[model samples]
Target chain A: MVDIVIPPLGEVEEVRVVRWLHEVGDEVQAGEAVAEVECEKTTFVIEAPVGGRLFAILVPEGRVAAPGEVIGKIAERAGGR
Target chain B: MREVFWIPLGRVGYREVLERQRRLHELRRLNKVPDLVLSLEHNPVITLGRSADPRHILADPLALEAAGVEVVTVERGGDVTYHGPGQLVLYPILNLRGWQRSIKWYIRALEEVMLKVAASYGIQAKRVPSRPGIWVGNEKLGAVGVYVRGWITMHGLALNVDLVPDGFRWIVPCGIHGAGTTSIATLVGREISMAEVSARVRAAFAEVFGVQVRVRDPTGLEVMAR
Candidate 1:
């Protein structure tokens, strides 16, 4: 269960959440496009790492998140009947 | 063209280059001689990281375009970074399986290569804890941002070398706003030739990664990177 954190680019400041491309309970695949943000408005897409059931957004849409902060989590489900 | 290859793109891409790398990867998966290397000079381009947004770029696209700079959104991880003519970009399509397949270890080895190369020019650089990349006095001297698929790496590091640091002012370097960057020449209080940096880095990479350094010209880079 690894948490996804933001990486440093040529940036030194924070960013405001522009949009969320997934909802809670949504399934994501590794390298699949997940969210979009304004890096000052460059409008690029963020991809998912490791496929699993995505948890609800921790940092909601329009919220500003700092670098290296965890935006979401992916946990494995238990029990096969 | 027979012995070595040289490609002067003059100014082109970020992700588009990766797309080209991908096609070669398919051939590589088929066991071909994609053993090539490229030294490119861009006309100023911006690339986004794996978990980054274009909004982090503080520069205006129209303004960048107005300056004749091409803006590119790349697939590599890390944040928005600038690449220009003064910045010598090296893309090695070498199989990392020949090196180590672990991305974390691969990045660390890249740090060693950059650090040793900087030392050759009388510059001292180090890596940050919990964070990867070479730093000089809190300012990054070189950036290690790459994309690895099935253990193959693309999109190598960005060493300041003699590049004008102000060019990085156009965007949030590696996505950290306000954090400044450093360069080899800047540290020594003089301008060093790009040729020197290239030579040192090539040697350092070969030493750090423990592989034979095969210098391939630009024309051979295409199939070589595959």
Candidate 2:
């Protein structure tokens, strides 16, 4: 399993999730943007670290997230369907 | 030093330049082109951002229309703001990963560029707490509104050189009340040429970002867009 967390965004410790590009159970490729977050009036996209199926979304749109906080999880393989 | 193209498009309409930025952004994302700093003056227009409140526009539609001011909603961050001739707008299409991957750092670097430009004219510009623009005491000297996707940036800062008073009077600048806008010409009590301000901005950007700014003809950018 791979965790999707907000990357360190220089001096800003918190960001609000603007939206998710993929829903849970959707497949996402490595480096593909899976979510958008806003920090200090600037919007940034959060990309998936590894290609996999989006397994869970812990933080939904409009919720604030901190750097290093896991906002979602990706399952690396389709297991047992 | 890392190099960035500085393309000056003198006196362009807001929508046309916006289309240009979008095209450059796509090229940059695909790693086809280097970072660019597009400097230009916009025809009179008021633009609102994603979090903008329409009520911030105090002027009625008919009055704005009579003044030839067009209201546009954009994808950048921040509230309503005005753009017109004599305002130098610099849209730096950059991949943040090349500099620092922090939006906060990028915005501060932009403000640093303007603060240095203002300082060259003996004006003290600063950033207010919780406010995201370059301010001279209570009045705004420059405004910043940016949109970043995939760590690539578009839409950028604008420094007021010699502003048209009527354009700003149409809205609460940046949706902030009480505070007004001021220009380099107004603060210095003399007409500062846009060319002079543009030069200062170019030098300041190079100094602040530690990049070699190569002034390029806008025609080359057209070739790149093709």
Which candidate should be chosen as best, given TM-score against the real structure?
A: 2
Tens-digit per-residue lDDT, B1-226, candidate 1: 1121223343346556567666655555455654444556555677766556677778788888787666765556566788875676766555666655445566677788888988887777888874567888779887766654444556677677777535788877777766788777778988788777777777776677666665544456454544
Cα displacement (angstroms), candidate 2, residue A59, comes to 3.1
Q: Rate the local accuracy (lDDT) of all candidates.
A: 0.64, 0.88
Best by lDDT: 2
Indicate the residue-level lDDT of A63 in model 1: 80
C-alpha TM-score for every candidate: 0.68, 0.89
Per-model DockQ: 0.06, 0.57
Please provide, for model 2 over B99-176, each residue's C-alpha lDDT reduced to its tens digit, 9 standing for 90 to 100.
998888999999999999999999999999778889998999998988887778999999999986548888999888
Per-residue CA lDDT of candidate 2, range A1-81, in tens?
Answer: 989989888889788887799999998888888988876667677888888899999999979999999999999865412
